[model samples]
Target: MKVTHNTAAGTFTLTGKMWSNTYPLDQLDAWLAFYRRQRDEHPKSGNSYDKGIAGLGRCRHSSRPRPADQLALRAEGQAGACVRVLGRWAEAVSRGKG
Candidate 1:
């Protein structure tokens, strides 16, 4: 997957499988904050936290995974990529590089 952050647009984009999706950075920031809180509250449930993040991404993007749906799987993977991208962006922002 290819991830890009556009500071001018305040957007994060993930591209793969000949498709791309863009999300508002502010929304992703909110999601990260909530995810961190959930992680802190339930530190032992790593899988649960991942599911929650994926679910939120799917919901926000109107992507519903279906059985035998490779495209859906690809989209889900892109969502995960988006999470990683946003994490890196957050770090950059904190370090004043964003």
Candidate 2:
């Protein structure tokens, strides 16, 4: 799977049979978190994490953030956390846990 961050567009584009979803920055954390948790709890489960990510991608798109952008700014930290979690999950999966 290939996931690219288009800074110009502020979007994440994931492409592959297993990961074909365009995820907005706003909802990236939730998607990463749900998949990470499932992977952590069931490392050996085949494709659960993949399925979770895909399922999240299929969910209705999140509405744009409200004009009060303070809350969204505060949640910027979550974006980093999500990246870390996704990294670990990917490493584990690559090592054959899944």
Candidate 3:
């Protein structure tokens, strides 16, 4: 997955295999804020929180997971990459490097 923050457009675009989504900066900010609060409130449920933030979960609708879901599961721990990318973007913007 590749995430790019377009400052001029005020959006974050996430591109993945055969799928892509563009989200408003404020939307991402709200999600991150909510997740951070959830983590602080329930420290022991960090994994669940991360998965929630990453939009990752089990395939409950079928007996076998789809190929895409399997790929996501394999990329489990890498979910935080998106968050890290956002953080770096924020830092760069803050430092007048935008």
Candidate 4:
């Protein structure tokens, strides 16, 4: 995936493929954040936290599942505002009326 962080616009972008096609840039950004956190903690690469990208379980929908859908539970672990920030960034970046 490709990411571009435009501080001036306060936006973050995550780009990649989903279900054989580009899964909207906004979706990509959300997935990317989750992947990064997951990737770093996983025991291995390519297989680390790569199981919950499509809203699947096993990952429990946490915010740092590497590849899980962390749109809701990414906060209970770290500081208490990570999830909000992530969602905000995603939503802010997802703006622009695409």
Candidate 5:
């Protein structure tokens, strides 16, 4: 996956294997800030997204977030889901599951 920021548009473009998505920078930043707060407040939990913070969960039409869930991209809460996807991808790589 690749992520690029467009300062002019104030958005982030996330390009994955066969799909791409654009999200408002403000929304993404807001969700990251929330994730940081959650991590700091619960250090023992180690920044787990499984609790569904900021509406992290399966998409309405599927059991999990996917490129096909374009509807979720319109929701502010789903901004965090993008971060969560990146987080999970990192974790999988670290564990040699990617």
Candidate 6:
């Protein structure tokens, strides 16, 4: 991904691809959408979006932050079905069943 900062003085550029496995394809797509909207809207003094998104830098969400069933995760937490993996064959490896 590319990041650029422009102000009265000049411009600065930052570049990096995702540095973590937590960034799955679907999650990356959704986050790119959020950033695109932020760029389009240009909200919050032209810097808040950067700060807010940067705060999430190198940090993994417990789950996808957008378009995922937050309620499902919370409810599953209470119901003892709190599985984080989403693949059809993903499961605990304790019994060699992952």
TM-score for each candidate, following the candidate numbering: 0.30, 0.39, 0.32, 0.26, 0.31, 0.27
* Model 4 segments more than 4 A misplaced: 19-36, 47-98
Candidate 1 residue-wise lDDT at 46: 57
Q: Pick the candidate with the highest lDDT.
A: 1
Error of 6 at 38 (Å): 3.1
Query: Which candidate has the top score in TM-score?
Result: 2
Residue range 1-98, candidate 4, lDDT tens digits: 43443222233444455522224333544655667678777756765345444332222222222212443344445443555546555664567421
Clashes of 2: 0
For model 2, residues 8-76, the per-residue Cα lDDT tens digits are 234666567765778776666676677778877887987746754754454323322222243244334
Off by over 4 Å in 3: 31-98
Weakest lDDT window of 10 consecutive positions for candidate 2: 59-68
Better of 3 and 5 by lDDT: 3
Candidate models: Cα lDDT each: 0.56, 0.53, 0.51, 0.43, 0.49, 0.40
Clashes of each: 0, 0, 0, 3, 0, 0
Backbone clashes in model 1, listed as residue pairs:
none
Output the TM-score of candidate 2: 0.39
Q: Answer with 4 or 6, whichever has the higher lDDT.
A: 4
The TM-score-based order of candidates, best leading, equals 2, 3, 5, 1, 6, 4
Candidate 6 structure quality by residue, lDDT tens digits, 1-98: 44433211122333556432233333443664686578668755566456436533332232222222543444344433333333212332344544
Kindly give the stretch of ten consecutive residues in candidate 6 with the minimal lDDT sum.
4-13
